[model samples]
Target: MSNCCSSSSCETTHPKKHRCPANGSEYSEVSARTIAHHIRDALRWRPTANRYFFCDDPACDVVYFGDDGSTILKSQLRTRVGVKELSNDELLCYCFGITRGDFIANPANRDFVMAQTKARLCSCDTSNPSGRCCLKDFAKPEM
Candidate 1:
């Protein structure tokens, strides 16, 4: 499974459900292979685990898991991956290194940025820290 942020169709047809042991928050399963590639160093891949989960809570860092019901902590996870909520100074566009502050400071640039992203002007799949596209998050009205 590709990262959900990569494209509009990243959602699973039948998301495997699990309750977070750390937070009791319900989460859907994602591909272990995808998670492994995203956080290769952080994850201790379990041969028995077929799926993994990502805790979207910014306050939580329990990002990766395995089939054997194990998890990887935030400290083990990669930094600057854009998986966490963007701090004011953090890059929203990992490919172009555009920060949230840049957009807030100049709202007009948002459209231009969106246009560039929609046109596939950059290699987001390879360049993005999350190994996904920014458009799904960037194009949100709340952003």
Candidate 2:
């Protein structure tokens, strides 16, 4: 659940990158740990030892892909991928459970997330499907 880069499986000295078959977008490297946390228990056994990537394309059903031509769709995950969700209620910050709607309602939520993140309380690695920081995903309030 810690930094994926620290894990041996996530190390990418010579990564074998792959594109998302569903959308044909270049893959973003991800950790098996991230896949393990997001993937449904039944599908946990689906992953191979190969490196994995995250498909952030909202229009695509695929959430994870492996260098060995394996894939895990959003439907196979334990939690809804916020980026893929069409609803404003989709979670933007998994660590604090802040949804798009909540952030839109109160921009202060962003500040709270920032504070928590700065305090080293955020755990985006396991909670977030992308295994990345959620601060960049926050929707800025309209002035």
Largest TM-score belongs to which candidate?
Answer: 2
lDDT of every predicted structure (CA atoms): 0.62, 0.83
Per-candidate clash tally = 1, 0
Model 1: per-residue lDDT, tens digit, 51-134? Answer: 666565566767755546788766665655554665777676776777777767876666776788778796655555444566
CA RMSD of all predictions: 6.7, 6.1
TM-score per prediction, in order, is 0.61, 0.82
Tell me the lDDT of candidate 1.
0.62
Candidate 1 C-alpha error for residue 105, in Å: 1.4
Which pairs clash in model 1? Answer: 49-67
Tens-place lDDT per residue, model 2, 107-143, is 8899999999999999998889898889878853331
Which residue ranges in model 2 land beyond 4 Å of their true spot?
A: 1-17, 42-46, 139-143
- Model 1, stretches more than 4 Å misplaced? 1-13, 16-18, 28-34, 37-48, 81-86, 122-132, 139-143
